[model samples]
Target: MAIAELGPVVLDCPDPRALAGFYAEVLGATAEGDDEWTDLKVPGGRDLAFQAAPGFVPPKWPSAEHSQQFHLDLLVKDLDAAEEAVLALGAKVLDADDRSRSFRVYADPAGHPFCLCAC
Candidate 1:
């Protein structure tokens, strides 16, 4: 038998519903779950889930004090457009270099780092 195949990824945050909503908007998915847990499913396949973590400590990007542990790499059609859209949806640029680069780092509303990649 083969090893376990990957399923959905779950992120821990202070508010599952709100965090789920943010990912839902980003992936054009829908949030489904109660106050304790929420799930967001992308149209094609990738799935994301969120759970409420009381006293959740957000990771400080570019700092080893609190590691990010994990982050999502999102493919976008246009970097500038994606930047604008994500900014409107509560994503803050953690570190943005020259536009000529293919990827940029950002922090979600919950402070988890994710990358917007033009690939």
Candidate 2:
């Protein structure tokens, strides 16, 4: 038997509900769960879960001051459009410099750094 199988990647945030909702919108997934725990379910992709972490400290991007154990890389057809949409969904730009790059970094509402890749 296989020793382990991949499961939903869970993120620790101050508010599970809020974080789950943000990602759900970003990934076009559905958010479901209680306050302490939330899951973002996509139609044909791995699911994402969020859990409430008391006194949670948002990760510092491009800095080792606090650990960012995990991050998601979302593929987009148009970086400009995706950037606008994500910003509207409460995501903040962390690194806008894309000069001849395929990906750009951003921070979600809770400050988790993620990237939008064109490749």
Candidate 3:
């Protein structure tokens, strides 16, 4: 018999609700579960879980040491609009590499860095 698979990604955050809310706003997903740990279900059955870690320390991206372990790259239809929307939702723009490349770096409310690339 074959074993069934589970959720693809499990993300740790200092505040599960905040993380879940951010993801839900970004991906149009719904946050599920209680206060401790929450699951954000994306399209096509892909799931991203946010577990609460009271002492979570967010990673610093593009650094020599203690860099971000993983970053979500989103292909945006309009980079400007996307950046504005995310920023309005509490994401902080880390760098605007418009002179170098097409993608711009941003950090979530919890300080997890991500990228928004023009599609």
Candidate 4:
């Protein structure tokens, strides 16, 4: 049988609870099940799973030294408000290029870069 569609995207983090909490807050979802592996469901039948790994390395973004394997793009109503909410939820603001009015880049607790777009 051929692969149907993409399943849940799993991410390795030093602490599943922390990473799960970040996404839970950002996506307005809750972490269900155990602490070792937390599943956070998203809208439109999408889901993200965060697993605990003893040796998890946070990615370095903006620097081309190590490539960023993957990133997520989220559409928001307000950029400033979304940025504030995410920052409060442990996402660090990497940089905001004034040239782009629609999107800005931010990193999660594990330093995985993601974009917040106003749409």
Candidate 5:
């Protein structure tokens, strides 16, 4: 038998609520929970959770010194539209130069690296 079922992917951020809100908007989910911890309920998939990390320093993108420990990949049919929406939602472009590429990297409000991939 399998050892255990998977749980929500948890991320540490300075403000759990704010980070959860960011992911909620990106994933088309609802943010739930309290100040110290928050969860984004993603339809047809596992949930994403955010936990408060006092004095949290966001990981550096493409840096060997401070590697991005993890990243989320979101599939989209329209990369341009998705990019615009995420930028409006406070996501910063980490890398998007190669137009031919199937994916683009962005940093959420809390500075977690994530990708918007062509579906």
Candidate 6:
């Protein structure tokens, strides 16, 4: 038998509700929960959760010292549009030097790295 089934991907952040809201807006989901814990019910995809972690330190992308613990790849139809939207929503560009690549890196409000992929 399989060991376990996949569940919601939980991310540790300083403010659960705030992070949840950010994802909700980006994914067109709803943030449901309190400050301590929040859930984003992603439509047609794996659900996501956020938990409050006091003094949480976001991982450094492309860094040997503070490596990126994990990252989310969000598939979008148009990279330009998605990049604009995410940037407007407080995401900072981590890497976007190559225009021919299928993906671009960004850091959310809490500094977690994520990619907007066109693949």
TM-score of each: 0.95, 0.94, 0.87, 0.88, 0.97, 0.96
Cα misplacement distance, residue 50 of candidate 2 (Å): 0.4
lDDT of 6: 0.93
Indicate the TM-score of model 5: 0.97
Clash pairs (backbone) in predicted model 2? none
Find the candidate with the highest lDDT and give its number: 6
lDDT of 5 by residue, 88-116 (tens): 99999999999899999999998999999
lDDT on C-alpha atoms for all candidate structures: 0.91, 0.90, 0.85, 0.83, 0.93, 0.93
Model 5 regions more than 4 Å off: none
List, residue by residue over 1-119, the lDDT tens digit for candidate 2: 99999999999888899999888888899999998999899878899999999998999887777877788999889998999999999999999885578898999999999999996
Q: Model 4, range 1-119, lDDT digits (tens) per residue?
A: 87797888898887777888888888887777576888888766479998887777777776677667888888889999999899988888877858357889999998788999888
lDDT of 5 at 65: 83
TM-score-based ranking: 5, 6, 1, 2, 4, 3
Count: clashes, candidate 4 = 0
Error of 1 at 76 (Å): 0.3
Q: Rank the candidates by lDDT, best first.
A: 6, 5, 1, 2, 3, 4
By summed lDDT, the worst window of 10 consecutive residues in model 5 runs over 18-27
Q: Please, what are the lDDT tens digits per residue for candidate 1 over residues 1-119?
A: 97998888999999898988888888899899988999898888689999888899999888888999989999999988989998999999998877778999999999999999997
Deviation from native of the Cα of residue 97 in model 6, angstroms: 1.6
Q: What's the true lDDT of residue 68 in model 4?
A: 74
Note the clash tally of each candidate.
Answer: 0, 0, 0, 0, 0, 0
